[model samples]
Target: MATSVLVLGAGFGGMELATVLSDELDEAEVTLIDKGDSFVFGYSKLDVMFGREPAAAVKLPYAEFTKPGVTPLREEVTQIDPEAKRVVTDSGEHEGDHLVVALGADYDFDATPGLAEVDSEFYSVAGAEKMAAAIPEFSQGRAVIGVCGAPFKCPPAPSEAALLLNDDLISRGVRDDCEITFLMPLPSPVPPSPETSEALLAEFADRDIHFVPGARIA
Candidate 1:
């Protein structure tokens, strides 16, 4: 009998792993389960949030993932039992010969105070869309983007959001009235690579984007 595998999460990593396993292991049973009905890539989230692209354009329907030996289950996993090799999801209980947990990191807005209160054009798609909807209404206002912690998803995204906001204001002929700034805890835009950091610094300077480094705003 073939091994029955239950893969948790439908993110990029999990999807890739399951696809590879299904291709390599012919007789094995692989099930990819996620709570979300649609799959959206990381970058696509930004695209929709900034109003550069529509939500439907970024959404990939779960039903479209038709591959051999791969079953996509749209359900939220409630609990896991390692000893029994079983997982309980909103759909039902599943016993797998093998289990792969590729669930991505969950964002905790509570990580920083005033984050939820303030307008975050970063983080999640819904947040971005909210900002996008607000952007068109703002004829002149300070649009500040802040990063509260390390190990964030899409490190360059916050900066990108600032730049995009700058662009949007410029396109709307309100660049002169709009003030865009980026706040980060790092000493540079991208501290991992100095050259990249320097380049980003130059770009920010050129774009007139105020860069606040090594400072965590309250």
Candidate 2:
């Protein structure tokens, strides 16, 4: 019998795993499962928020994904048994010789009270669209780009949001009327690399974006 592999989550990790397995083992059976029918790039949320592309255009269907021995299954994974090497999804249960769990991080809005009541966020496709619509009406105010919690998805997103908002405000001729602040729990943006962190700090200074380090939203 061919080697059976179960790959959960259709994000970058899962997709790559399926592809590599298919390429290496001709007789392998690879099943890639994800709740979402289409995969949206993390950066694509920024694109939509900035009005660079519509939300409808950024969605890439898993059904269109093609690989030799890999099959994409659109289903929500509800349970996993590591000992048994089995996964139960909304559709059915799957058992494989090898199981890979690559489900990406999810937004935990409930962790902080009043977070879901906020006007907008750029973390998700729908949130980005809501922001794009709200931008035109935001002529003047203190725009705070912040991370609600540590270890959230996309470390650089707050920086990206700040810069993009600054550009947008400037383009609308209201930058001087607005104040943009970026808040994160990390000591500095991009903490792993000193050079990149310094560059980002310099950029923030140049753009007049106040960087509030060691600050976590609750």
Candidate that would win on lDDT: 2
Write down the TM-score for model 1. 0.93
- Stretches off by above 4 angstroms in model 1 are none
TM-score of every candidate: 0.93, 0.96
lDDT of each: 0.83, 0.90
- Error (Å) of candidate 2 at residue 170 is 1.3
With a 3 Å backbone cut-off (N, CA, C), the pairs that clash in candidate 1 are none
Which RMSD does model 1 reach against the true structure?
A: 1.5
**Clashing residue pairs in candidate 2, if any?**
none
Best candidate according to TM-score:
2
* lDDT tens per residue, model 2, 80-110: 9998999999988999999999998888888
User: Model 2: runs farther than 4 Å from truth?
Assistant: none
Estimate candidate 1's alpha-carbon lDDT, on a 0 to 1 scale. Answer: 0.83
Instruction: List RMSD in Å for every model shown.
Output: 1.5, 1.2
